[model samples]
Target: MASVDLGKVLDKAWADKPLAEVLAAPVSALKGVSDRDGELLDEAFGVKTVADLADLKYVRWAQALAALDAAK
Candidate 1:
């Protein structure tokens, strides 16, 4: 996949609409994410919205776990 400048798209969209609209938009619009990641995120975490990504406890835990694992 190609690189996507999500922040730029979001800034432009937010100027024309509500924050909810921007968040509800597809994750594909974001930068550097493959179709596979979107599908897996939707299935594994039910992360349909950008807002959902913020609330992912398992992801947060896993990130921390990876950091610890790498440090060892």
Candidate 2:
């Protein structure tokens, strides 16, 4: 079987433009996320994929929301 194309797996996610939504993708699927970032995220956040990202029940959403509000 061909290896999964994780990069292609989440192309639609980038277009959606929501961190909560995009976080559901494989961490490897993101732009600019070097393997180093992947390792760090997994270790620090238990975030191996986008679903983990969306599930972050902490300060991220609040921070993003604050940034968005500040931009207004």
Candidate 3:
């Protein structure tokens, strides 16, 4: 299993949470993401949680594109 230091990517309040909890947390729980940004994402894409954002089709497509570009 891979271990990551959540503190670096998550807000202080969320840093020590379990992976499931972290994934279920609001997008704003992520470091540097504000409540307004979360609301915008929600409004634009119906993304509310970290998992929702990760599962968004646009996000997946962008990641695939980035990976393909990196591989080229």
- Tell me which of candidates 1 and 3 scores higher on lDDT: 3
How much lDDT does each candidate structure score? 0.68, 0.69, 0.96
Best by TM-score: 3
Whose lDDT is higher: candidate 1's or candidate 2's?
A: 2
- TM-score of candidate 3 versus the correct structure, residues matched by position: 0.91
| Per-residue lDDT of candidate 2, residues 1-72 (tens digit) | 677454555554474556565666577657666668878988998888867755677658787899899999
lDDT of 2 at 67: 84
| Location of the lowest summed lDDT over 10 successive residues in candidate 1 | 8-17
Q: Write the per-residue lDDT of candidate 3 for residues 1-72, one digit (tens) a residue.
A: 678789899999999999999899999999999999999999999999999999999999999999899999
Candidate 2's C-alpha runs over 4 A off are 1-25
Q: Clashing residue pairs, candidate 2?
A: 23-50, 24-50, 24-51, 25-50
TM per candidate comes to 0.51, 0.49, 0.91
Could you give candidate 1's per-residue lDDT for residues 1-72 as a string of tens digits? Answer: 677554665544344556677667655445555567778889988987666775689878898999899999
Candidate 1, residue 55: the lDDT equals 67
TM-score, predicted candidate 2 vs. hidden true structure: 0.49
Q: Which stretches of candidate 3 lie over 4 Å from their true place?
A: 1-3
